[model samples]
Target chain A: MATAADITHIACVVYPGYDALDLAGALEPLTMLSSNVPFQFYVVGPSLEPVTTKVNASVVKTVSPSFGQSIAPTHTYDNPPEKIDFLIIPGGMMFLDPIERQQPTIDFVKKTYPKVKYVLSVCTGSVILAQAGILDGKRATSNKACWAWVMENCPNVNWVAKARWVVDGNVWTTSGVAAGMDGMFAWITQIYGEAAATVAANVIEYDRHTDASWDPFSDAWRTTDPDHGKSVQPKFTE
Target chain B: MATAADITHIACVVYPGYDALDLAGALEPLTMLSSNVPFQFYVVGPSLEPVTTKVNASVVKTVSPSFGQSIAPTHTYDNPPEKIDFLIIPGGMMFLDPIERQQPTIDFVKKTYPKVKYVLSVCTGSVILAQAGILDGKRATSNKACWAWVMENCPNVNWVAKARWVVDGNVWTTSGVAAGMDGMFAWITQIYGEAAATVAANVIEYDRHTDASWDPFSDAWRTTDPDHGKSVQPKFTE
Candidate 1:
């Protein structure tokens, strides 16, 4: 059974080189849930200005719109909803502007993590979380293409090598670009029950990756560098 | 091999209640392909103003951001590029503002279809193409959740019941929201090469649904209304 009253305001953080696609998968399911659940989500950036998003980590991170899609933000980190039940952070910044250059957004995540009911990181988004000292001891997963880089950068965090997504208490982390959808659905199933998740997935014709351990990218792409967008693809046995 | 000069400019149309999610799946592969292929995609609208996007057609079309995500457009129909190599139309208008009310966009599609090298429609975007008199006597597919309504409205189109996507010459039409990704990848394979498509899919960690006729949503969701976002889900056994 799902209770709408407890968790209502959801804030999705958008940043330079943010992968809007990572959030889209979760948004589709959440949007359907909002109908009956009354939960509302908004895009939040460092400022209210428009931000261009990218996910092709292999390519050079150019500010040009030709590289990605531009999105408008309704809320900023300095001025967000009074109560945020869920906070979602997407990856791409690490590949573009490195963790050290992303101080403001990182600081915001650190400060707000304690207040939010739950937090989710997609791909290298977990690296930002790890930098913020949030996933210090938590078992999390990240983009497999840059497995060594992520592990090397975050030594304190227990990075799971094989997982479509990981759930360690209130924190949820996913692998690569598309795995965020599987994680979000799994999170939704846990919070709103299996029925709600099923309906959300079916409505969008999304084949939900039910098993969390159903990940082969970590093993297959362990040696592959994130710079090589051209690689052999791994399939999920649905 | 995909030549860099052939089809370079792609225009993605975004409208009221447009599903950015549908485009996200397509863009991921296309973005990767753009590296060497030189094909660039841009978001376009009826006007320069920001447009809110939605895919949960079950909900009422609200202009408010609470109901959907807002995306900024780089170009408009009245003033578009000198040449558009590929035209990508996304669905959501048919579910929100009816085709008759979407005169500007519908007219744009009708006028641009013949000029472009190739045209692609995602989900109910096919319905828009059908409304523009482009799908007449052509094989196509649409959102299975609203199959009856689409069929009733567009009687001339040869709608396939069990197809992930349908390609008739230069025009490609997909099944539902997420099916567009599968279709776009297939289209990529056809235009570029199997190797390029495979790399793009793998880079994004997207499991490519290769079969053209591997569509179960059409059969399973024949009776489900678009309004009913909750229903039984269909899956593809990998």
Candidate 2:
């Protein structure tokens, strides 16, 4: 039973080189909820400067705070909502490598996860979550193309490779770019109840794909060489 | 040379039921072209009530010297550019049937086509063009899904069934929605030159699919389709 009050604050963190759809997919679903629930959400990026996507047609802007850096009640819908209930991180091609290595950003994710109700990632964003050490012994997933790489670098995490969306408790991740939309709906279903989420999906005409739930890493991995043992793990570039 | 002066004006005609992408695709390419050429374009619909898309997320304000009303080109960008270089119609799901039967609108298109230098349609926009009898006996194309319907209704027209774009003299039509972008570049190529169009395509990173031009109604039709005898005509119930 997710009420409008339950979603007091929502923030999408965007860094330089963020993918447009990675953020857009999540934003679209959130707006559907907003259109009905009347919750306040804004594009929060590194700065006020407008950022263009890699494709270059779409433009995204940032939100600013009028109050002190930290505001009230864990989560308020004011100019600067202090309490964050949901924090979404969208991955773009440019942010792929750097964000995984960004220590300060990792610390921020680590610090914020305990406070937020749900921590979400789209596309390569799961890599960032992995580097932050949040997925240790936790079931997680990432962009399918990068799953092999994730397994080698972040061994502590159990990766679900075959899912369009992998949800384990409060941590959720999605595959590729467009799959983020699926991930958002999955999030909405949990927060707003299935009926509300289904109606929202119908309004957008997006048919939820079947491969949308979480599974363990063993059955999820797909390797080309059957002769080669499953012992071969993913490798990191740096 | 398609010099800046050659394109004194551009017209993006909007109907009561128009798709946003068609207008956008045409506008973005034209805007990109404007960097090299100076031209102005405006949105003109049947009325001025702030037309909305089928999905209703975006709203486009309409302008006029209404279609049948007398035009004083000096007053607004609503009129086709000074030379009437380009007249574009974007397609939307609303354009599927009933709106296509509007007498005054069709009459305006019928009367106006020969007067313009280049007449173009994006997606189901060819429905309007066909209904106006502009496609009669002309070699053209439209969104792939609507090809049979256009052929059945606009009998005299020779439809190209499988092309992303088709150019027949000054008349051009595109398959599907995004193809309008390619069609615009093609139109610019005809007006300016291949070189400038190539540059514009490069700016957008448009990877034009270099497939064979598909003309299902031509002599090549006999070689490809043995069952060309079957005719599945589209019925537009207005």
Q: Name the runs in model 2 displaced over 4 angstroms.
A: A1-4, A55-80, A94-96, A99-104, A210-238, B1-238
Per-residue CA lDDT of model 2 for A1-238, tens digit only, reads 2355777667766554555446645655564455456454544443433433322223211111110011011221223346678888776543234433345445666767788878889876777688878888888766544455556667888876566678887888877555676788878876777876655443333335435753222232342334213543432110
Q: Against the true structure, candidate 2 has what lDDT?
A: 0.55
**Candidate topping TM-score:** 1
**lDDT of each residue in B96-201, candidate 2, tens digit only:** 4455334555666676677677778887777778788787777777654344445555677787766667777777887655567667776776667777765544
How well is each residue in A1-238 modelled by candidate 1, as lDDT tens digits?
A: 2244568888888877777678776677777676576667778888887777854354453323475777788888899777888889888636544567667778889988999888998888898899999999999988876676787789999888888899887899999888888888998888888988876676577777899998767556753345433452222110
* Candidate 2: pairs in clash: A74-A83, A75-A83, B2-B192, B9-B81, B137-B156, B137-B157
* Worst lDDT 10-window in candidate 2 chain A: A63-72
**C-alpha lDDT values of all predictions:** 0.76, 0.55
Q: TM-score for chain A of every candidate model?
A: 0.87, 0.73
Give per-candidate clash totals: 0, 6
